[model samples]
Target: MPSIQKPLTKRAWVRLPSGRRLNLLDPTPFDFEADDLALGAARTVRWGGHSVWEWPLSVAQHSLTVLAIGEAEAPRPLTAAQKLAFLLHDASECLGVCFDPISPLKPFLGEGYRQLDQALQTAVHRRFGLPADLPPAWKKPIKTADKRAAAAEAIFVAGWSLAECREALGIRAAPLSADPLTPIYGGLPWEPWPARIAAERFGAALAGLAGSMP
Candidate 1:
């Protein structure tokens, strides 16, 4: 067998634990690995790491929060694909420096950022058998769930008050008073996990979801 050719040093690629290189500028469905996404998301800090707890909140934890809120409030159970979509919503951000830029900063960065994000999202969708354009039925629940999760994180994890999350953060919904994951994980509600635990849990979750897909 021939040896695999290495990517050029100048390309926008990051090496993963699986010994694969994901090219950010031109990512493909085949490039995503569960563990890579998990570890990357676990290291990515939300809200600039301004946390009340000793450890900062990771995107992996936030994704689970979004999933929990989405699932719990729905009239019926969300399908595995739908849940996976929620979990991987920000998977694109896991590609590089593990930095999750605040939503407010996107406007200043302009179109290129959005284009790249969309490209990666399309790849993620295809990799997991989701439609490139997600279902319209997903609109309301995901929007509401995502907002509530952000508000809860702001108040409980990031040292913000409900008033601040509303007036300043522009999150109109009332923050969740209780930890959504408490019944399942049994930790201090809304407290951030260490990166290693977050990564392992996220990896396992992704595997379970993928395995459940028909």
Candidate 2:
């Protein structure tokens, strides 16, 4: 008689740099750490590493840029939570597999991914002590700032023509002089920072913002 062979089970969890494991298949409550966020985000490249720069832009830089833009555009001083929200807008992207923007892929990937993304986003927000759903008043400005960063990224790093980027992203590139934050666009022509520096800067920014929270 032939013996029955045992089937192998696949591992569904991912271990982060900080030694914490996240189960991708099952949503569970896990403590969020700034170090893990910084490390993961620093290593995740934007534009799916399709940028024309010598080094691919990391999501860490993108997050920082968005925060800067939001800070500059706020009519009055922003709260600590609002600043943290901007800095963490892409924190879920640190998960690596779900980093792609959903707009272009939504039709093909359908609503499943969108739902998953939102779930992850809510978790991230909760981890940082923010409301599960961002208030619309804050959400709008952050999204606008994010789009402006996207337009700048498309033009400077991805090497897309202004018209092409504008049409694709549905956002007009703000004039470089329109805001102090706009200078980040000019710096895009330079090579991206190394992962270590990106991580450090992200961590530092988070610390600074947390200290300033009122």
Candidate 3:
């Protein structure tokens, strides 16, 4: 009789601060907690820990910035769901245990990472009562706002030149009055907030948006 062999299982789990383990490769349906998002995002650094700020800018702060930009740049007022979607646009990044620039990794990692990323994003959307996919009309403004936010982040926090950042992000140079280094959106300055404060503010914003649901 030949010896029977069992295949080895690859580990693809990330443990949350809440002690919950998520299998990133094949995540099971799980409830998304606002606390987990707030805390995790607050700790996740933007620019892959390469920011020029005194402390790394947290994803929580980045989310608030994007939401603010989306609201300010939208042609009309956005509904609660739209606002939530904007805030959570990068929520999937918080679920990952490490940071890898997606653009650079895509060619090597291929579609598998993208599928996992989308699954995490859909999970986040469902958790907050948003549709898994945003309508086409809404996506444009959100994406534009997101790019503007990225342009500002690159210039201010990541120490990139204005021309270079704009070119890389495909955004127009900021107006003289709207200095890229000192950009303001939604009447809020683009400065990095403390991690704890960012987490608290994110939770508050999430609560307000969730409460507004009919």
lDDT of each: 0.85, 0.74, 0.74
With candidate 3 superimposed using the best TM-score fit, by how many Å does residue 70's alpha carbon deviate from the native? 1.2
State in Å the error of residue 174, model 2.
3.0
Tens digits of per-residue lDDT for model 2 on 1-214? 9999989664467777777777654434474567877887888888768777677888888888889888888999899999999998988778635365535655777677666667667777776678889999988999998888877777777777778866776557562333333365344333576789889988988888767765
Model 3 residue 13 CA deviation (Å) reads 2.9
Q: For residues 129-153, write the lDDT of model 3, one tens digit per residue.
A: 8888989987887777767776777
- Better candidate by TM-score, 1 or 2: 1
TM-score of 2: 0.82
RMSD (Å) of each candidate, 1 decimal: 5.3, 3.7, 3.5
**Candidate 2 backbone collisions, by pair:** none
Local error of candidate 2 at 206, Å?
1.7
Pairs clashing within candidate 1: none
What value does the lDDT take at residue 114 in candidate 1?
83
- The best candidate by lDDT is 1
The candidate maximizing TM-score is 1
lDDT over C-alpha atoms for residue 47 of model 1 = 89
Better of 1 and 3 by lDDT: 1
Candidate 2 accuracy as lDDT: 0.74
